[model samples]
Target: MAGEKRDFNTAAATWDQKTHRVRMANNVAQAILGALRPGPDTDVLELGSGTGLVTLALQPHVGSVTAIDSSPGMLAELEKKIAAQGITNVRTRCVDLEKDDLPGPFDLAASSMTFHHIRDTDRLIGRIFGILKPGGKIAIADLDSDEGRFHESNEGVFHFGFDRYLMRKSFEAAGFVSVRNRTAAIVTKPGPDGGVRTFTLFLMTGEKPARETEGQ
Candidate 1:
């Protein structure tokens, strides 16, 4: 969380009022987890949990989740959701992922719509791989393009939104094998000025190969 971190605390307060936005975000979050296809015993770690929109969606499919975010306000919202749902397998932590050492060896690591604010995506991805058990998977879902300054005044680092080439290169350089990018239908919605606009979201998936078994 650096560069221009969006204040999710503010967003959380009004998120319910924004029906279209909330539904759209939840839909995307669900889709990200759906694609991961984690089994019942998988241990997951989510970066930038942001109110547990994705964390809760993942609960039914995995053994446990450790959700991390930088904002206490956002984490508080997630806690409320957890309590309401009677979910006990989810844990939340507020910390800056860029500078913190997270406990890991997670079977799957995920982050959604959070990379744009990061200054070094490569280093971050490598750190993720280092903490994952060999053969673990990583997935990141984020904006494919800024859609013409949607938050011109407040947008964060946002390096390569439309450039999958650059993003894939960075993932591979981070030591992830079998990296691939998936593009989904452009999401169209009404802008602040009452005009419709479209933006594409991309999912990047990668894997760390399993270690060679002893005596192989």
Candidate 2:
């Protein structure tokens, strides 16, 4: 996790800016949030909320949201945005996912542009499943593939993104059903030296079965 702590703070500062990179990332995030069929009673939990971008996007749709992230700086920015927007329904918490237990039984759980940062995919999925209520849904939006050499050079293991097929299987193994992966185009401009890149991200979604079938 080379500079993992630094990258998020930088992102939090420029989160509201309309740069191409920011726009692309937020687009994917927004798409993931949009997929959840939120209700008036829906209690949503968002993992890795940066600067309240996704939290603000989802607030109007759900009953309430508890946004969690590991970065204190990011959470500070989220607090500022929450106050400015006068959004009282959204609560921000700084939590270390690798160490802390996710609090829930939430009607739905969602993460955007965060899960790829985690290396232990199975444990992460299992934790999410543990907190979800029966028939609850989990939606994750992240890079489809982690193949860039830069990531390898920077972080020991860049997670290689997520495999759609493997993601579905993991969710199924965790007792979710109606699992599927939805792809959408995410446009990013070139850095100071590199060319522009357009990434196709997948929003993998699954639901916990209301009840197990007979004869299992």
Candidate 3:
């Protein structure tokens, strides 16, 4: 975990310079927005909000956002962007999603491209379930399973990508219902061998069942 944080921190200064990264973030945010259709009263909690690209995109549609990331350097860049844009609805925290407790009971929880970094998806999904309010939704955008070519090196990656079926099963195990998954975007990047590689990004969503009332 320490090594992964260090790598991300080192990449923070130049993270936004990659056009593909920005485009992927935008596409992910769009997918989540379309699925969740957040209202002015929605309270969102974002996991792994590196550099706040999605956070900024989401702020306009929601009442408030609590963005969490493990990398301090990434959060620093996000804070800078938030200040520059005068975005008052978003707040940030540097905390590990795996080891730390999240602040929540949020109407929505979302994440993009960061799940592959975590070692345990099932446990994380359960944690997310606990933090959301009843009937809350979770929207996650991440890469589909690939032949391990996307990341040139797998130093920090826990899952090369994810299988949609397994992901949905995990969501169900975590007690989410009305689950749906679909392709959200496709990204082409230059491979190490000078070939173009296409990676598919998927959007998966599920909703926590609302609490039961005394009378039917």
Candidate 4:
């Protein structure tokens, strides 16, 4: 969390071996599908899509997916999976979505467990708004407000979870409408005290409203 560097590259090879992590991704994907009910015409852009856990889960439901992340190692692993499975619609990009220009105009944008690593949440949301088609939607799954104890070490964590009400405000500030959230998953991990701690995952969804036409 604070002192150590959490390298997804170093962890990529064995990432899917972690059963709980995989389960968490599946849960997040299910929650997103429940909220979005995307169609075959939906083009998806996923941010911080580590190893394509959530990306692959949602790939079958969408027209296409461009999964982006900052870790080359993680992307490599994802590439392996796509190649092995002959996945034709999902592609990967290794870049910082917060600063880089990506090919988009997507119908949906989604992420799982990646929001806490971002420092400027509102800016990213606004950027997504700009990249998305009007009436496009976003589904982000993350931990609820926790007092900095979710991670064992603070690698690149920017927030110790988030407040749903305030997060809805951020969505609105980015011109998103019909914002809503619900508990998506419950995970238990060994806390710093060596005991099991339960953490709640939330799936937050919102839609970008169609812009108004110029006044007549």
Candidate 5:
């Protein structure tokens, strides 16, 4: 949450007005569902859950969700959605996961298109590992390096995208096992040049070793 953090507070009002963003979130949510298969017993921790597009979608399938974002504006919008829908399983928190510690022995820690804003992927992954319960799963959906064209401005963006192989390495370095990645979704948008370009969103999942069986 540094280096020209996007004004998510200001952007929160119109965040869901864009059709492309909604569609992309739906696609990412489906990818999470397919990978994790969250049930009523599952407690989910969502990182960078701006506006709850993916958060609300996944809420019905899981036991409970703690959606964390750096911007209170975004969480406010998410709260509105939760209230409007009369959903009780979802909650929102405004915090910078990059600098703060979250209390969650979550069954799954997941995010969509949030990794690029983080400065240190390895550190964030390791932090996630610490908060998850034994055998908890991690799933992330993010862009493949596009040379910083994924947004209108790259002011707050850390990594334009990520190398899938290296991302897996980071997970493994965090002591997560059974790590794997897949093409979660593809988003086509207008580039800065006014030309249509497609970007890859990958879903990477891994498991923290259970206490009883390390790396089992």
Candidate 6:
């Protein structure tokens, strides 16, 4: 975990220069915004908000956004962007999700291109569920399963990608209803062996079921 943080921190200066990553983050943010349609009163929690790509895009629409990442350097970069844009609705935090508690009970929880780094999918889903208010929503965008060649290095990657069917089951088990998933984007890149590779990204959304009333 420490090594992964170090690698991300080291890459913070140039992370936004990767066109593919920027495109992916933009697509994911758009999907999330469309799905949630956040208003002035909505509160959002963003996980793995590196360099504020999605975080900045989201702040304008929601009431407040708490952006959390494990890398301090990444958060610093995000903070700079937030300040430059005069985006006061977003706050950045450096946290290790597995070990630290999140400030939440948010109206919506979202993440992009980050779930693959987490090894315990079920536990993370449950944690997200726990942090959300009843009837709250979650929108997560990540690469679908692929051959292990998409990433040149896998130092911090816990899963190459994810399987939608299993991921849906995990969401259901975490007490989310109205679960839906769709292909959000497809990114084609050069493979290590000089071959063309296509990676499919999916956006999965689920809502925490509202509690039933006594006499309804």
Q: After TM-score superposition, what is the CA distance of residue 150 in candidate 2 from its true location, in Å? A: 7.8
Model 6's TM-score against the true structure: 0.93
Per-residue error for 144 in candidate 5, Å, reads: 0.7
- Measured on C-alpha atoms, candidate 4 has an lDDT of 0.89
Clashes of 4: 4
Encode model 6's per-residue lDDT on 1-216: one tens digit a residue: 212523688999899998988888888888888876888898999998989888877788889999999999999999888788787889988888777887788999999888888878789999999899988999989989875666887778877788999999999988888999988778889887888888989999999877834673
lDDT of 1 by residue, 1-216 (tens): 125656777777555575544554566656656666797889999998887777887888889999999888888888898889889899999878888997788999988767877777788888998899989999887778674444434455556464777878888887788888786335677778888877777888888878844773
Tens digit of lDDT per residue, candidate 4, span 1-216?
464335779889998997879999999999988899997899999999999999999999989999999899999999999999999999999978657886689999998888888878898888888889989998988999878888776688888898999889999888889999999999988877889999999998999888744771
Q: Against the unseen true structure, what C-alpha lDDT does each candidate score?
A: 0.77, 0.76, 0.90, 0.89, 0.89, 0.86
The residue-by-residue lDDT of candidate 3 on 1-216, one tens digit each, is: 213533689889999999999999999888989987998999999999999989888999999999999999999999998888888999999989889998888999999989998888899999999999999999988999976778877778888799999999999989899999978889999998889999999999999889834572
TM-score of 3: 0.95
After superposition, the stretches of candidate 4 with alpha carbons farther than 4 Å from their true spots are: 1-5, 213-216
What's the CA error at residue 98 for candidate 6, in Å?
A: 1.1
lDDT of residue 182 for candidate 6: 83
Arrange candidates, best lDDT first: 3, 5, 4, 6, 1, 2
Writing each residue's lDDT as its tens digit, candidate 5 over 1-216 gives: 237667888999999999889998999899989987889999999999999999888988999999999999999999998988899999888879788888688999999988898888899999999999998999999998788777887878989899999999999989899999999888899876879999888999999988745454
Query: What is the lDDT for 213 in model 3?
Result: 43
Q: Which whole-number lDDT from 0 to 100 does residue 46 have in model 6?
A: 94
Each prediction's RMSD to truth? 3.2, 2.8, 2.5, 1.8, 2.0, 2.5
TM-score of every candidate: 0.87, 0.87, 0.95, 0.94, 0.95, 0.93
